[model samples]
Target: MKANVWHGKNKLQVDNVPDPTILNPRDAILKITSTAICGSDLHLLDGYVPTMEKGDILGHEFMGEVVELGSAVTNLKIGDRVVVPFTISCGHCLSCEEKLYSLCENSNPNAWMAEKMWGHSPAGIFGYSHLTGGYAGGQAEYVRVPYADVGCFKVPNDMSDDQVLFLSDILPTGWMAAENCSIEPGDVVAIWGCGPVGLFAIQSAFVQGAERVIAIDRFPERLRMAKKLRAETLNYEEVSVLEALKQLTGGRGPDACIDAVGMEAHGVGMVGAYDTIKQAVRMESDRPIALREAMMACRNGGTVSVPGVYGGLIDKVPFGSVMNRSLTIKTGQTHVQRYMQPLLERIQKGEIDTTCIITHHLPLDEAPHGYDLFKNKQDECIKVVLKP
Candidate 1:
């Protein structure tokens, strides 16, 4: 089977790897049909996340047909089309019982490693890194899904793979981000970054009854997409985002602010340059310009929601502003399982369209070029779907 394998920093290759088989009684083998490159994948590709090994498979958002199932799996059978959540969970665990699937205590085979970093282990994620689970990702012809009964959501026959695939991650992530904001009716929301997650955040805010959404990004293409969704956009490169947001919100700032651009945020001045220098010198693990700006730009009592992926320690966050303004902050990896069925129902009901973000589709073999195109923002790439 050909899989996208990670080599080193800024390196990914399509290589022939052995096909996967059921490794546990609750496992199932899936024949992957569609997979996507996530913005978070760039963190791994750029050597931001640690505990990665060479030859690791690199994808998380994917959906496909079940080819085989282990003896204990009963919820699904052969030939069932399903979209698996990125977070691997055991249904009966405390976190899983509470519907916090991403924080499941039993999924990560490498819990100890994560414990060393964060004092606890979260769920193992597909194709993330050894820190998450060391599980091979779905960016291949086939993948082995563990805890199959709990993780795989059966896709309705009427829906196309493209329609439900993002339920595996970003769609749910965006929804969860918005939900965390607790938007009241007629509230104004400001989102940083117009990437897929940010765009989805905009849509989700509206779904949650936000009256206005302001999307900030430097890319005209991305900002244009936000406009199509009825969001006001700000080009951070062309204008002072904080000032413009203040003006637009009548000096109150947005009722809620979202930081959708995580570790790789770009700013127009010395702050961005300083972060770059710190990241280059290993003095800071992530760039927090977007997060800092979000904190500072939020209304005095507003919420700050973050769906962006940040892997490590950040430098120079404005804690004073966060505390002085009595801001509320919420963020985490999406509990994909919790939102999978709900978001799928929305898709089925014509409430939202998830396919608009797909800007490129390619065979699995061209994954290297796909990564380059997405990372460089080349050809206005917003998302890439890989078919195996």
Candidate 2:
């Protein structure tokens, strides 16, 4: 099998690797038909997330036919097309019972590794780093899916893979971001970043009954995409984001703010430089530029929803403002199983255009080029889908 393998910082190669076999009673092997390069994957590519090693498979948003299934997986059989959630969860755990699948205690074999960093471990994610379970990702021609009964969501026969692939990650992530906002009727939501997740956050905010959504980004193409969803746009490079939010909300700030841009936010001026210097010197692992702005821009008593990925320690978080303003902070890896079925219904009803953000398509062999384009935001590329 050929896979996109991580070598080192800014290095990836399409290499042939051994095919996966069922390793657990609940496991299934998928012959990947479609996979995507997620914004979070860039973290691994750039060495933001720790514990990644050479030869690690690198993708999580994927869908395919169940080529083989283990005996314990009774709900699915060969030939069933399904989208696998990135978060690997055992069905019987307390976390799964409570529908917080991402925090499932039984998934991550590398839990202790994560515990050392985060004090608690998250669910195993396909093709993330060793901090999560080191499960081979679906970026290849095939992958082994553990706890298949809980992770695979079978799609309808009529839908294309492109329409359903994001059900595996970003779509649900964006939806969860909006849900975290707890948008009230006629409320305004502000979102930072205009990438795939950010664009979906904009649309999902509308679906959750937000009367107005303000999108912030420096990319004209992404901002235009947000506007297509009826969100007012602000290029952070052109104006003071804090002042703009204040003026846009008539001095009250947005009811909620979503930081869809995670650790790698392109910060402006000295603060950006400070974060870069700190991170480069190994003093900080993430840049919390968007998070700081979100905390400050949110209205008093409002929610700050984070759908972005942060790998490690951050510097200079504005805890004072959050404490003073009584802001509620909600963040986590998306419990994708919780939202997949409902969001799939939205896609079936034509309410969400999942394909609108996809700007490039390439064969799996060209994944290296795709990654470069996406990482640099070249060619107006917001999303890239690879066919394996």
Candidate 3:
């Protein structure tokens, strides 16, 4: 098998690797057909997330056919096409019973390491880092899936891979972010970042009954995509984002603000430079530019929904404003299993076209190039799908 292996920061290579075999009674092996480069993958690529070792396979959003299955996996068999959620969960846990799959206690074998960092362990994530379970990712020709009966969602025969692949991560992530907003009828939602997740957040906000959405980003192509979804656009580079939100909402801030841009957010002027310097000197692990703005821009008593990925401690968070304004903060790794079937139904009904954000397609061998393209936002690329 050939996989995209991580060597070091800013280094990746397509290398031949041993094929995976079923290691657990609930495990299965998938022959990957389609996989994608997610925004969070860049965190590993740039060394933001810790515990990533050399030779680790890198990708989580993937779908494929079951080439083999273990005896305990009664619900699926050979030839079943499935979309595997990035969060690996055991079906019988309390967290799983409560439908908070990402918080499943039995998934991460590296839980103690995570406990040292976050005080508690979340679910193990495929191909993320050693902080999560070091499960091999699906960015290869084939990979093993643990707790297959719970993690793998069988894809309907009628839907295409491009239409369903995102169910593994970003689509459900966007939906969950919007759901966190607790949008009311005729309410306005503001979102930062115009990347894939941000674009989906814009669309999902509309689906959740938001009367209007405001999108913020510096990319013209991404802003255009938001416009296509009928969201008003603001280029953060062109105007004061706080003032713009104030003016747009007629003196009141937006009802909710979504920070879709995670730790690597590009800041402007001294603030941006400060985060850059702090991160470079190991004073901080993440840049909270978007989060700070979201907290400040949200209306009093409103929600601040974060779908973005943050790997470690951040500096200078505006806790004063969040506390003073009584803002409700909601965020987590998406409980993908909770939303997969519902969002798939939406795709089947043609309510959400997941294919609209795909901007580049590459062979699995060219994954290095694909990563470069997405990381740099080159070629107007919004998303990159790799065919294995």
CA shift at 196, candidate 3, in angstroms?
A: 0.8
Q: Compared with the true structure, what per-residue lDDT tens digits does model 1 show for residues 39-88?
A: 98988887777567999999998999999999999889999999989989
Candidate 2, superposed: residue stretches over 4 Å from native: 266-288
201: Cα error in model 1, Å:
0.6
**Per-residue error (Å), model 1, residue 385:** 0.2
- Determine the C-alpha RMSD for candidate 2 after optimal superposition of all C-alphas: 3.7
Candidate 3, 85-194: lDDT as tens digits: 99999979999999999999999999987776677999999999888988889899998999999989998898899999999999999999999999999999999999
Per-residue alpha-carbon lDDT of candidate 2 for residues 69-165, written as tens digits (9 for 90 to 100): 9999999989999999999999788999999999999999989877766678889999998879888998899999999998899999999988999
Candidate 1 lowest-lDDT run of ten: 266-275
Candidate 3 Cα lDDT to native = 0.90
- Estimate every model's Cα lDDT from 0 to 1: 0.88, 0.90, 0.90
Candidate 2, residue 155: how far the Cα is off, in Å: 0.3
Clashing pairs in 3: none
Error of 1 at 86 (Å): 0.7
Candidate 1 similarity to native, TM-score:
0.95
TM-score, each model? 0.95, 0.95, 0.95
Per-candidate alpha-carbon RMSD to the true structure: 3.8, 3.7, 3.8
